[model samples]
Target: MNFSGLLTLQKERVPLKSIEVELEVRDHVATVVSTLNYENKKNKPLEAVFVFPLPGDAAVCHFSAKIGQTQIVAEVKEKQKAHEEYDDALSSGQQAFLLEESDQSPDIFSLSVGSLPPGESASIRLEYVTELAVQADDGLRFCLPAVLNPPFNPQYKYRGRKCKSFEVVYVPASWLSYSLSFSARVSSPRPISKVESNCSLDPLQYLNTDQTQATVKLAAGHKFDRDVELLIYYKDAHQPTAVVEGGQASAEPGTLMGDPMVMVSLYPEFPETVMSSGTSCGEFVFLMDRSGSMDCAISKSEQEETRMSSARDAVLLLLKNLPMGCYFNIYSFGSSYEHIFPKSVEYSQETMEEALKKVNQMEADLGGSGMLEPLKHIYNQPCIPNHLRQLFVFTDGEVWDTKDVIDLVKKNSDSHRCFSFGIGEGTSSAPINGMAKEGGGHAQFITRSDRMQAKVMQLLRFALHPTVTVTWDLPKEVSVTVLSPPIAILFKGQRSLIYAQLTGQSSEAAEGCVTVKYSLAGHPSENQLHFSLRPAEDTGLTVHRLGARSLFRSLEREEREHKEHEDGGVKEKLVQLSVQSGVSSSFTAFIPVNKDNGDTIQGHFLRRNIPKPCEFTGRNFKW
Candidate 1:
C-alpha cells in the first residue's frame, strides 16, 4: 500500500471529492497542509474533517485521531516557563494523538499544530501498519482551526482510503528537497488488544517505544464516555467524535495549494438484483419521525437546521421512486401517528406523485421524540398474503428508548421487512442498520441535500429486489478471511454482506462453488454464485452495477493470486484486493477525490461514502 504522488497547484482553495495515502507498514498515517505561519505564537491551528453520508439525510460527524493538548517541548527552558500553558508537559508534549477504534470515513479526524517559536520548526508524519484491518468505508479529514468569517481557505485532499502513511512533510527554507518520507516499520509475533471486542478493534501495533507511541487503556469502558489521546486511535471510540477544528485566526494567510483530488468509485461485492418471490406484490410503509430533532442540519451557523427538513426531502424522493403496481404507505411519528397517504394506497402512476406531495407536506413538529408507539401500532396488524411489507423508517437514529420499536420489528419479522433510513447530524446509522439486519432488511443515510435523490433511489431499488434469503456457501475457508466480505447480496440489499477473505489458498477455490438461495416470486427462485478468474465471463461484475472498472476489481486480484500460488497457483490478486474492495483488504490507502485536487489521505470511507447510492440496502446490524 506504499504510494507517493506529486501535487503542484497554485490555487487558494478547492473542494476535493476524495484522497488516499498508502504505506508499506501497518503504522498510523497523518496528513498536513503546509502554509507559512507569519505571526509568532499566533495560535494558527488547523484541523482535518470528513463525514459518513447516510441515506435519508442522516449524517454522523467523527474524528479519527486526537491531540489532547498543544503543549510543546521547547528546547529553551526560559521559553517553556514563559509559555507555560503551551509548554505544560502533562498534556503538552504529549501531543501525538492516535486512533482508538476501527472505522470507515468520511468520518472526521483532525491534526492540530500551533505556531512555532520564531525561527523554530516542526514536522509531523502519521503512521499506521499496512495490515488487513484497514478497509473501504474508512476516511480522513484535514481541517485547520476555523474563523468566524468565510473560510474555504487552503487545504489538502485524500483519495478513497489512505495508505499506511501520507504526509505533507514540513521542511525549512534552509534545505531544498530535504523532505522526510513518511515511512513505517512494523514487526510483531503476537496480537495486541487496543480496543475491546465488538465495541472496537484492537490497536494496529503495541507501544514498545516511548517516543513513537501513546496508549489509551480502559478497564471497563463506556462506548461514548471513553476518551484517549493519539492521532489515529483516540477518535475512533463512539462511531464518530466531534472536535474544534480551525482555531480563531485574525487574518487570512496565503493559500498552500495542491493538485485536484481523485476518488476511486466503489461497488458492492454482492448480487445486483434484489432477491424476489417471483411475482411483484409488495407493500412499503414509511415511518418518518418529524419530532423536534428532525429540524436540525449541519449549519455553518449555530442555528443549524433540523433533521426534519432533510427527512422530508428524502421521503419525497422515496415517494417518487416507488415502483409501479406497488402498495405503499407513508406515516410520520411525533406524539401521534400522522398518515400521509390517509389509507394504505395501492401504488400507481396516479398515486406516486400524490405521495410525493404528502411527503413534502411534512415539517418538524418540534415535539419530543416518540417512535415506539407508532411501531407498536404498525406491528400489531396481521399479515398480508402475496405482499412483501417493507418499513422504511426515518429518524435522527435516536428515540432515547428504542427497545420497543426493536421489539415490534422483531414481532413482525416473518411477514414484513424494515429498511431503516437515518437522518441528521447526530443521526447514528448503527441503529437503523441494526434494525434492518434484525428484520431481514437494510439501512442507509443522507449526509447532504445533493445526495438525497440517489440515496432514495438506491433504497427503492433495494426494496424492489426480486428475492430474499440471498445466501452463499464458499467452502467456509474461502469465506473466512474476507475482511469485509460483502455477501454477494448487499449490492442491492442494505448494509454490507461481507464475510471473510482467505489468502495463501487456492485460486479455483477462491472462485469456489457459491450457491445463492433466494425466494422471489410465487415460484420461489434462486441463483448460483458462479464467478471465475477468466476475464471474459460476464460474472455481472462488469455488467450489472453501473459496469464500472472500480466495482469489478476482484477479477484482477483473482488472476494475480492465481498466478502466485505455489500450491501452486494462488495469485496475489485475492490477497491483494483485501485492501481494495474485498473483505479485510482495507488498509490506509490514498485516493484522489477530484480530478483537480491533490491526492487525499484518510481512512477508507472517503471512497466508500456510507449509504452509497444503489448499494446493498441490507447493512449488517450488530451493535
Candidate 2:
C-alpha cells in the first residue's frame, strides 16, 4: 500500500518551483502582482507553459519567465471594490482566491510544464492591479466564507482550483516574537452559539485561564511573548444550540434572531504573541480513534480488512517519511487508549526498529470512544519545536464529546496544530472540520490507502513554512471583507493566506472616518490605529470570494450533519454549492471542480432538508 503505485509521472514535465505575490493597497483597491518560478529539478529536459484559468475579461497583462531556455508567466488586471462581499466565488472557484458561493462558471485554465533541463531553477514575476467596490455598513459585522473544497478557500483545491494568493519572504529574527491577528468586524451584530474556551460551556462561561497576559514591559530589546486567540465573532443573542446551553431553539422566519455584529477581539492581551526559549524539532503524534464501529466492513467491497488495511498503510507510509530530528508517539483509542511509547522516540536506528516492531504488532481492536481525553493528554504533554508535535489521528467515523474535544484543541492553540485525518464509512465531516478549525489546524480525507503519502507530505510541506508566525494589517481609509478562513496560499501551505474578503474605501466615503488595527512585535501603542482607502478599479473577484467562503463553510457544516443523519436538505444546499464551485460531489467522495463550470458538469452532495430552526422538517433547495 505504498502510495507510489498511484503516481502517474508526467512525461510532459513543466515544474513550477517558486511562487510569489506582492500586494499594494491604494485608496479602495489593491494592485496585486504575482510571480511563479518554473525550473527543472529533474534529471531530464522539459518545456512548461503557464495555464491560467481566467479568460481576458478582467484586463490581464502577461509576463514571461526564463528558467535557462524555459520560460512561463501570466498576469491579469482585475477591478474590485474595497470590502464589498463576494457571494459569487464558488462559480469562479478555480479563478479566485476567496472560496465564496456562486454559480460555478467554467473557464479553461491550466499550467503546462514543457521543456526543462536537469539541475536548473528559473524565476517568474507577474504584476496586476485590482480595485474592488466598497460598501459601507453601519455595523462592524461581516461573514468570512470558506469552500469545503480546500475545506476553506485555498489557492488550489482538489483538482487544482486556482484562487488569488501571495508568496512571502519570511525573515526570521531570532529572539523577536511576532503575533498575527486577522478579523472581519461585522457590519451588524451576529450571535455565536458555540465557541472554544478554557472554561465550561455553561450559561456563565468565562474567558481562558490556562495562560495569563505578559506583564513584562516590551521595549526595543525585550522578547516577552504569549500566543493569543484572535476571535472574530458576532454579538450573539441569548439562544441555545442543539447541545450546549439548553439545546435547541426555534428560528421564526420573520424574527431576526441572533445578533449580526461579528466582534473582533484579541484574547489574553492587547498584543498577543509567543516566544520559544527551546530548540525546535519535528515530532509526530499518531492519535487514532479506535471507536468500535470502525470494525464495520466496507459495503460492496470484498473484505472487512478494507478499512483497517488502508488505515495501517497510511500510518506506515507516514513513518517511513520521517525526516531527521524527527520523533514520534502513537496513541490509539476506543473506549480507552494505549500509547506505543510513554514518551517520544527519536528517528534513531534502535528507536525506529523498536517503534516499527511495536507498530507492526499493534492491533485494531476498540469499542466506540470519545476524542477529548487524548487531546487533553497531548496538550499537557511536554513538547518542543524540534519535536515537531504532529498528532495524526486515524479513525473510521465513530466519535464522542466531539465539540468538547474541539474546544480543548482551540484552548491550547499555543502548543499544537492537530491535523485530523478521517477515513471511515460515511462519517459527518462537520465535527472533523470543527476539530481542525478549533486547533487552527488542518483536516484531510483518506478514502484509500494509496493516496496517503502525497496527502501526508502535503501536510508536512505545509508545516515546514519558514514563517512560523505571520501577520498583516489593513491600511487607513480602506477596509477588507475576509470571505473565508485561512487556506493554502500557493499550494495549500499555511504561509499562503487569503483573509476573508473585506471592503476598502477612502475615509471620505464615510464623511471621512476610519481606523485600522495591526498586531506587531514592537509597536504596542498604536496597534489598533487608523488608516484610509479610496476607490480604484473593479474586476470584482475579491468581493466575490469574501462572500463565497463565508457562505460555503456554513453550508458545509450543515451538509456534513445532514449526511450523518441521512437528511434531505443537505443534498439541496450541496447541489447549490457544487453548482457554485463547479465541482462534482457525491455523498461519497468529492471531485475537484476546476475543469468544468455549471453547464455540463453535474453531481452533488447537497442537503435535501433544512430543519426550520427548532423543528426538523427539512426544507429543500431549488437545484
Candidate 3:
C-alpha cells in the first residue's frame, strides 16, 4: 500500500485548499486551533482522507467540522466503535467525519471526511494543548510541522491493508498549491523578553505596559516548506511556578478530571563550583542511525551536508570532549548493527583513535531502519562497575514499533539514562522524545538551520551532570498524588514539570512547599518553591486535561508491558479517562456523524487524497 500524500482510490488533484492556524500561549502551555479548508471539485460526491503529524505529547481535546451552515462537533469514543459508526454513516448516504490517532505512533493522525457533495466546501477545526519544550537557552520552543513524511512502520495498516513500503514525496515550495496563515498571542505572568522564529515574523507587539502579554504573526505570503518554530523568552525563566486548575464540573468527584490538579514547574540549580567541576567517571554509549534516508540533505538549504555526515561530525566532537577515565563505546545500526568494540572500553587515546577511524568510514548503506535489535544489544551489555551508564542515540527516521522501543527504555530506565536526537526533517518525535522522557534524559531535534554540534554538546552536558532526586511537602490537610510520572531527570536552568492531584481540603490562605534535593559531584544541593493552595482563575480545565494525558500515557505504557494473561484492566481505565477528559488516545478516536437529513446526499462517493506539501528531500524504502 502506498502511504503517500492524501491517498484516494482515484488519481485526482487534492481537495484541500488552505490552512489557518491560531496559537494562544498561557505562560508555558500553548493551545493551538487549526482549520483545514477542503472543497470537492469533482463531479461525484467525494470522500477525502488526510494523514498528518502533531506533537507527540499533545492532548487533542477538540475536533469539529462545519459543513455549509451546520457545525458538527465530535465526541471521543472507542476506536473500533468510532470506526463502525463512521462506516455506518457512509453506507447510509450521510455525512460523517472521523479523526483517529495512529495505532503505531501517537504523533501521526488520520482524518476522514466522507460523503461531501460535489462543489461543497467543508472546514475542519482541530484543537490541541501541549507544554512547550524548554530550550537550552531558556526559550520556550513551539513547532508547527509542515512536512508529512509518514514514518516507515512495517506493521502499519492503512484502510485495512498492510503497507508494503513507505515513501515521502517532497513537493517543492513553488509547486505548493495550498496556503497557510498563522498568528500567535502569548501571555505570561513574568515579563516577555522577546519572541523569535526561523520564519520571518512581524514585529512583536506588547499589549500591556508590564510586557507580560504580546502578539505576533507570520509574514504574508510565507511558503509552507519547513516546520515553523517559535522561540519565546521570558524574564526570570528559572523561577518555579505552580498552576492549580479546578476540576471539570461534570466529571465524577473522585475521578481524574473531577479533582483539581496542580502543575508545578521546577528548575534546579547547582553550585557554581560543582557545575564547573564536571564528573570524570561515567559510561557513554553512542548509537547512530545509518539508514538509507540519512543520506538525504540535512535541510532544504543550499548546503550539501547529508544527515550522516553531520552526525559523524557531532560524534567526533563528542569523542574528543570525553573526560578522561570514562568508559565508552560506539554502535551504529541500519538493517543490522555493528559496534566499534566488543565491550565498553576505557576512554584512552588508542581507543578513541580506533573508534574515530570506523566512524569516518560509516555510510548510509543499511536497507531498512531496524533499531530494536541494536538497542537491545546495547542494553544487554553489562554496565561497567562504579560508572553511570549514559546512552546517546541519533536518528533521522522513524521505526515501526515506537511504543515497544519506548517500553524497553522505560523498563531499563533504572540502569541508564538515554539521550536522543532527531537529525533532520520528517524525523518522528514520538520515539525521539519518548526514550528520553522514559529513560531519564533529554531529547533534541536538529532541523533546518540548526547546527548538530551545538545541540549534541548541550545533551552531552546533561549526560555528564549529576543525578538528582525530588520530593514534595504540602499542608497537612491537603495530600497530593502525582498524576504524572516521577521526576526522572533534571538539568540546571531547564524546566521540569510535575502534575499532581490535590485531594482533601485547604483554606484559601493555606500554603505548600515542594523541594528538590540532589547530589552534584558528591556535593548535596536543594531548591525549594512555596505556593498557595488557591486554584488559578480562568484556567478552563487545561491543567486537568494535561494531567489526564500524562496519566493516560503512563497507563498505556504499563498496559503494553503487561503480560498477555494479566487482567490489569489498563485498557478500560484508558477509555474511561479519555472519554471523561475529552482527550484523544490510542484506544479512542473523535468520531462525529451529521444526522441531519438535509445534510445527507444520496449518491455514491469517490475517494480523493489531499496532497500535503512536504520537504524538498524524500526517502523511499520497503520493509
Using lDDT, give the best candidate's number. Answer: 3
- Give a tens-digit lDDT track for model 1, residues 523-572: 45455544432122211111111111222233433443455554323323
In candidate 2, stretches whose alpha carbon ends up further than 4 angstroms from where it belongs are 1-280, 297-305, 468-476, 481-623
Candidate 3 weakest ten by summed lDDT: 153-162
Q: Say which prediction, candidate 2 or candidate 3, comes out ahead on lDDT.
A: 3
Task: List residue ranges in candidate 1 displaced over 4 A.
Answer: 1-280, 298-306, 341-343, 348-358, 466-512, 519-623
Worst 10 residues of 1 by lDDT: 255-264
Give the TM-score comparing model 1 with the true structure, all chains together. Answer: 0.41
Give one digit per residue, the lDDT tens place, for model 2 in 52-98.
32211111223344455433332211112101222232343212111
**Residue 533 error for model 1, in Å?**
15
CA lDDT of every candidate? 0.37, 0.37, 0.75
Ranking of candidates on lDDT, top first: 3, 2, 1
Judge candidate 1 at residue 411 and give its lDDT.
55
Number of backbone clashes in candidate 1: 173
Estimate the overall C-alpha local distance difference test score of candidate 1. Answer: 0.37
Model 2 TM-score is: 0.38
